[model samples]
Target: MSSIIKELVSDPHSSEIISLAVGMPDPFLYPLDVFQRILENMPATNPSDFGYIATEGYLPLRRTIAHMLSSNGIETTPERTLILSGAQLLVLPTEAGLNLEILEDYLIRYRPKLFYTVSTYNNPTGQVLTEQERRELLLLARRHRLVIVEDDPYSQLYYEEKPPLPIKSMDSFEGVVYIGTFSKTLIPGLRVGFLTGHSALIHRLALEKQYVDLHSNNFSQWLINFYLEQGYFEDHLNFIRSEYKKRRDSLVKAIRRYLENNVHFNVPGGGFYLWCKLKGTITSGRLLQEATKCGVFFVPGQAFNARPTEENEFRLCFASQPEPVLVEGVKRLAKALEILQKSKTPRKISESFLKPIV
Candidate 1:
């Protein structure tokens, strides 16, 4: 089994418990009214509006997304964009069989050909690559003539500072395929995401999509278009950023106070997760099992790595739970650690032997 799956299975009640293993955003934070308005505004009055759209996606939605990308310094046109179900779907299939050797600098010598990366606020780990790392990876891709697929769903949700420019912005040769999703910022049920790359590549992907699902739902595309045009998405994103930031802060402070000094992790600037490394003899797998017994659960760190390593780490979500719940959860996690520490103590036996009773 994969290391992550193994760690999860090690949980005492792996079958039944609260889960922090997944990377989804908080449901309560979804922009329901904005999507509702968009749905209500769909031009069902015209039969053509409900029909199949071009496999590339709705023209206007693509245009708006292109505009959003350009505004962020990617310098791309709508013709270069292809809408997809979600960022992962867009990345997984296209990235298969690609050569990572092309970008040797960006990868560890043994890095997998396909990288399921989360450039900013990576799923589970929440470690955003530094600007220097981003440039090195881009340059590596260019030198090797390899494709670098950047999955950036959490860039906009940062709490402490502005997010770095997406790796797409550095693509002078159109070597990077950028996948973005609105599920985290907007409502996930919309299942709206887009892929941006060279026009030729996008055209081929659209063709593949045509044979598969024909096209995305026209009504949903139209609804998203209307929502973008109305300028409600920006305001909604700001509101989400503000509220999620507060929750993140609460979790960070609690972890610092309740967790042992040996547990180390970097505080994320914009994303929803906190990645932690436990110290000494305890492994993340063991901690997860103990945490479950105390009513706290989190994903083991091995899930993010494409291969196994010696590290004992895991990820915790600060955005999903309310502040009070987050605080309580950390306290319970601390209690679990105490139990594990005590279990490791060596018991002292009497030097003198006593006679046995009949």
Candidate 2:
């Protein structure tokens, strides 16, 4: 959430940080003019409408999201959908997808109350759970009587074929709590997200949420619902999808051209990150030190793991920067890697440069 990268880049703050660290959308792409128009022309509301509303968020917004989810195959009613932004559990992934055997093993041993995951274009790693995996996972959860928190913020940003229907879309057990956010899909500033699950569970969660903000921002919820209803979101999604794919491609090309075999990375089909492994003996911390000197920064993979066994991994986000900037960051990252390889003594980042994140 330290939006230091885009904020500093646009305004040219004194901070010398050129961050590829954060996993947020570029501010430049927000449809500000359209937002202003939506506001200026918004219909008036009652005085109470601006005050405390339902803790589950604006009713219209919930219904709107319900319809959207149903159309996408995750049949849910407004009663089962709650508006909010949210996160949990770490699962080590494989090239094929999530390691189902490991998760089942963990479940059988621990019988954990909740299992959380990103079944599509997962953050940091960009791995996805195949349809088979999703179905099998649902069965496992059902057998264990365990609940799943499926965080799916990046599915809409796919560059390849649309990923398999969300696990929630196929949750016959009604145990998958599907979470989505407009923060990535529509507007970040709004900070609006939605969760759909069992109606009883949603009510319990909503009751707990009541003490937090009393309710989500009424205005933002109303606006987003209108945005969806007027069909503004589809066009916006198409625009971002095209642009982010270009940035992803640019970052991939830059990494290969500069870093080459010094590092190993997975080229994600979508999502914002390029999860990389340091091929040499250098740890991510040492490389970050060199990278910082080069005016680039990334979150080390260790930060994402609770029980990190190695320090050779790191994450780079591609959605936060423009194509040229992504390439430039990668170039700087390559320089840092080079500096790390060549010198034990701390050295300056040569004037030349170039980097991504989850």
Clashes of each: 2, 11
lDDT of 2 by residue, 120-173 (tens): 888878999999999999998998888888999999899988988999998986
- Assess each prediction's global lDDT (C-alpha) against the native: 0.73, 0.78
Compared with the true structure, the alpha-carbon lDDT of candidate 2 equals 0.78
Best by lDDT: 2
Global fold similarity of model 1 (TM-score): 0.82
Q: Number of the top candidate by TM-score? A: 2
Residue 244, model 1, lDDT: 83
Error of 2 at 142 (Å): 1.0
Candidate 1 on 20-63: residue-level lDDT in tens? 55455667777777677655675444677678778999888899
Deviation from truth (RMSD, Å), model 2: 7.5
Stretches off by above 4 angstroms in model 2 are: 1-16, 86-112, 345-358
Candidate 1: residue 79 lDDT (0-100): 93
